[model samples]
Target: MADIADPRAVEVSRSATGALASLSLAMLLSSLSTSIANVALPTLSEAFSASFPAVQWVVLAYLLAITALIVSVGRLGDLVGRRLLLVAGLALFSAASLAAAVAPTLPLLIAARAAQGLGAAVMMALTIAFVGDTVAKERTGSAMGLLGTMSAIGTALGPSLGGVLIASFGWRSIFLVNAALGIAAMLAARRFLPPGEAGQDRGATRENARFDMLGTVLLALTLAAYALAMTLARGRFGGLNVALLGMAVLGAGLFLHAEGKIASPLVKPALFRDPVLAPSLAMNALVSTVMMATLVVGPFFLSRALGLSEALVGAVLSIGPVVSALCGVVAGRIVDRWGASAMVAAGLALMAVGCAALAVLPALCGVAGYAAAIVILTPGYQLFQAANNTAVTADVGKGQRGVVSGVLSLSRNLGLITGTAAMGAVFAFAVGTKDIAGAAPEAVAGGMRFTFAVAAGLVVAAVAIAAAGGLRKRRSA
Candidate 1:
């Protein structure tokens, strides 16, 4: 693929709409499975008789696999053919989900989950690359907004839908549904997308086109170390903290060294040359961290503090994604008028305010106070997310799209892990010091308040990064 300064410079067929929808649907399914499983986790653990630390691996496996493979798999797509990769990914994802639906033991289940992550990586790597092929550059924001909206909807609805399914059917229903969705996406992708070579190169040198093997190993090692260290630091492995920490250091050093020498690096060092990409990536990661933390911590608060039923708790938690979806729908139009940076800054401001309000739930005026704060926060976060994605995607040419998207996606995943782990640590520390066991309502409130405040601080830092990084000069709206 050649670097077209303007993706819109090429003529796009009207039929590409079908391709976009198919691709977006695949993305939605992939994101939906993640959140759906989040709610179904407790049920799965209870049914399987798994310990908390062990069950955490179920989620961690998928995330870690996806994080590690996205960039490398994406580069593969660039080498093979986007359509071929998409079909393969969808097939793998469906097969893995079926395996997950039938697994009888923890190891089988974990293996199945890891397979799903690999499938997801393929799907993720190819989906966005296909988007670049299907849509015009000028309309990328709008198209990405549609994708973002669908993702938000899937994310928001996943938990409630999973809860209902778990209540009516068994926990396996979640994986079964993913299989069904995957099958559907596979069929749709074949029918709608034109068959072609996915990762073809028209360039001069084979050396430049070779996969960044060292970089891939480094990336995998880096994420593994981080995940392992977090697990150890949580005291899951009573004596492995020092070893885990050492692994983290070693992995970081290897990743940096590999990134520098690779001709076709997973993370192109040139991306950092753009003043905006680095900070934008930071903001993306931090915001996701906050979102994940809140998502994880909120359930405990609603269940233990407010005494809400699981169904009601899911409904309340769903509000943000719902609003965020709506905001994403509108954000594209807003970005067209206001520019990407303004939208980003505004969205961050909204998230900050929303987080602050949620952090102070104990001080709310009435029963509806928490709900209102959620409504406020969700829309902003979603809008900011959509705008930020569009900006990052547009920052580079077609050749760089997959890699950029992969790294950006990786950052967000890392953020989610960090936020969840850190907040869990905070809540655990708070509860450990409390007089009551299982945490009193007041103690729950205090813990949540502290976490939300910390989340708010992170968002504020994102805002400052956006402002200080010369974004104002670029987006003058």
Candidate 2:
């Protein structure tokens, strides 16, 4: 079971188109499941006669499962077989969706959702890795961008589609629809995706590769603890939150220690030392943090500061995803034409400008101002995403692509959590109040300005990091 000369760099084959389509659907299903369930929370609450906090687990369970096991499953795919595992994941997801649709109780539904998330973890982790195996080297950025477009579309479509389904059918219809889509995705993946190159199929890789079960357990616990601390705080940090944070810290230390001892580590400590991978991952986190700020801060600014109606507020918030969806493919082409390195720097710069615009324009204009800033910001994000993903994943070896993609995804998710909790605190602090709901319009507007000012700084920091990494590489060369 010798490795392919360059397993990760392949020419486009006849099946490449279908493989990309299967991968796109996997990305869509994973992302769509994330947001679609949010719109159903209230309905779930009423159906189960439960409190909001309890029903929130319907979302949390899915999220936590992915956060915890995404990396482990990715590494598992590397060991077992990406094609075989991803196919299994789709089947599991479809089955779990059906179980969720028919769940007789709240706890059972939550369990089903958690199982579904586990399946999604495998799909999400492997989809991007497959891009390198299927697409040509020169067109990698375009493929990454296509996946980005699918993800954005899924996120944008989830709430609207979920609402329609809930209105026409029942709360159960959403999960039922997912079941059908999952089946379709499974069939496509099985039929279209090419078999793994020489060693990647469950031959020598399976026989020789070691899955770090201990490291995986420790990481999953740590991530779960950290995620719970973030979500459960609800803007109010209590003793439980503190304890959870402590647990996360302890778990991280243990995970690191275990990783240092592993033969085939889940995440190689050396990967972060690589100039391209480290900076790209760091930028991904920093950029994601700034982006999440828009979500956390946008609703308050729109409703409180701009005095927009709820309908208007929803529409305004929708602008970001719409822009992101539209720009994803365009960004990929730019990355392909210009190269990933240049696009990464360019993307970060645009985002910085967008942040500054958000800080000032809304204070001067109105909803138009906010929309304009988002227009600038969203394209930058898409550019950064496509370029960054292409840059880091373009050169990974056959054995490491799955875990590398997983780590990339992990960084983005962590950044989202950080932005939500920490940046939200910054916004609250700027508003000069803990209860943002009660803040004056002027104060809220001021908060918007202050928050974006901070977001701009974060983007600037990302630029600096990227520049520094590039300089170091050139100096060493």
Candidate 3:
């Protein structure tokens, strides 16, 4: 029980812990959408008679909207109130999930997914920023560990749950489940969480808190153009390939210019100048790229090569996150004893082992082979992911928490996109064909091998970066 002697301290603790629980639930719902549809993707493709490129859009659209809107929304939360943004996001997300479940056409599904992504952006941006706002500095590591644990559990369960739903009922069940969860979360948030604190300021200014609309527009264009180029590069757009490449570059340049000169930038350029933050952000991007690539590509291998069912495939894939989540608790304790840098480095080392094991999984004979590999890798991934978040936030002041959270979110999204695009291309190339439209079984296996190897290589690179650039927090003299 918290001490009631000091009313101000007690109030802050009660409010913050209550907010944390609500936000964790909201975050769980958001994460459910992230990987929940992964298992159902192939099923949806078969139902819609959609091309591979088109089906990829189902995943791409959600992530794209999240990437574009996360920074802006986080900034909005800081300017206004996290509680207000969180409740609103929950409402919007629920409505979008309902629409997604009943979507008739591919385009409608994509639009609904985008709306869901917007809701996700709101939830992710606010929850992370709220952690920095609500909790005292000394307890920050523990709060992050708990939050990270929730994320790992949500992500780990998402695919298996989606697989089970699709197997028994239908794909629509995934979205319906999200809607139910969202409604419950919304009610909880409204009942317990505080209202907008924008009017009560400790020197913060809402008068100058207009959203950087132009910066937001430019950033969206930049991300869209990049997606377009990646899609074209994969030979999706037959004739307009060169045009897509040009558009991507032009959009990138415009976004840079907008962010550089704008007073209220979509992404504050000044944050990048922080020696501690920049490398940590870059490390997150690289690390995420590796994790997402494995998630995206590894399953294809399991289903294609090992002949695993969707349910079994999701279960097998989840082993790593389960291990990672458990290890995150241990890592949090370790971070308290040592420093974030040690845990981060150790986590990356574990990830390297996992990636290597994944690459060589086919060589092993039975269930033990796969399990052994997962044991080596998953805990590492979870530990590093949590450590990175805690490390990044610890160094920044309270006022800059929202922007930092947004930047981390943006970095993560970009990494996932880049990893999927680049590695998807690499896998296609390994199979030695532009169109994997209907690849042979053996060729698919070979492609999977290539993808896993590439993922492993990326993690190894990340480990190097972490070792070379990762620095421990300094003790007070």
Top-lDDT structure, candidate number = 2
Cα deviation in Å at residue 72, candidate 1? 1.5
Candidate 2: what lDDT?
A: 0.91
**Structural similarity to truth (TM-score) of each candidate:** 0.87, 0.95, 0.84
Q: Model 1, residue 268: what's the lDDT?
A: 64
| lDDT (Cα, tens digit) per residue for candidate 2, span 1-477 | 997765443444547888999999999999999889999999999999999999999999998999899998888888777899899999999999999999999999999999999999999899988888888899999999999999999999999999999999999999999999999999999988987842242222455467788889899999999999988967888999999999999999888887777566777778878989999889999999999999999999999998999989988988988888898999999999999999999999999999999999998989999999999999999999999999999888888888888999988988998898988999999999989999999999999999999999999999999999889989999
Q: Candidate 3, which segments miss by more than 4 Å at Cα? A: 1-15, 39-58, 102-106, 163-173, 194-196, 199-207, 231-242, 303-312, 361-367, 431-453, 468-477
Whole-model lDDT, model 3 = 0.75
Better of 1 and 2 by lDDT: 2
Quantify all predictions' global Cα lDDT against the true fold: 0.77, 0.91, 0.75
- Angstrom error of the Cα, residue 62, model 1: value is 1.6
Candidate 1 vs. true structure, TM-score: 0.87
Clashing pairs in 2: none
Model 1: residue 241 alpha-carbon error in angstroms: 4.1
Q: Cα-based RMSD of the predictions, in order?
A: 5.2, 4.6, 4.1
Worst 10 residues of 3 by lDDT: 468-477
Tens-digit lDDT string for candidate 1 (1-477):
996665553333535877887888888987888888887778778988988778777877887789778877877767666677788989999999999999999889889999999999888767766666776767766776787788887887787789889999998999999999999999889977877654434332555777778888887877877766665545243457557668778987877777777566666666666676788889998898888776777877777877888778767777778776777767776766677878899999999998898887534642366788788787777678767877877756555666767777778877877776676777666655433237787787778788788889989999998888755556754
Candidate order by TM-score, decreasing, is 2, 1, 3
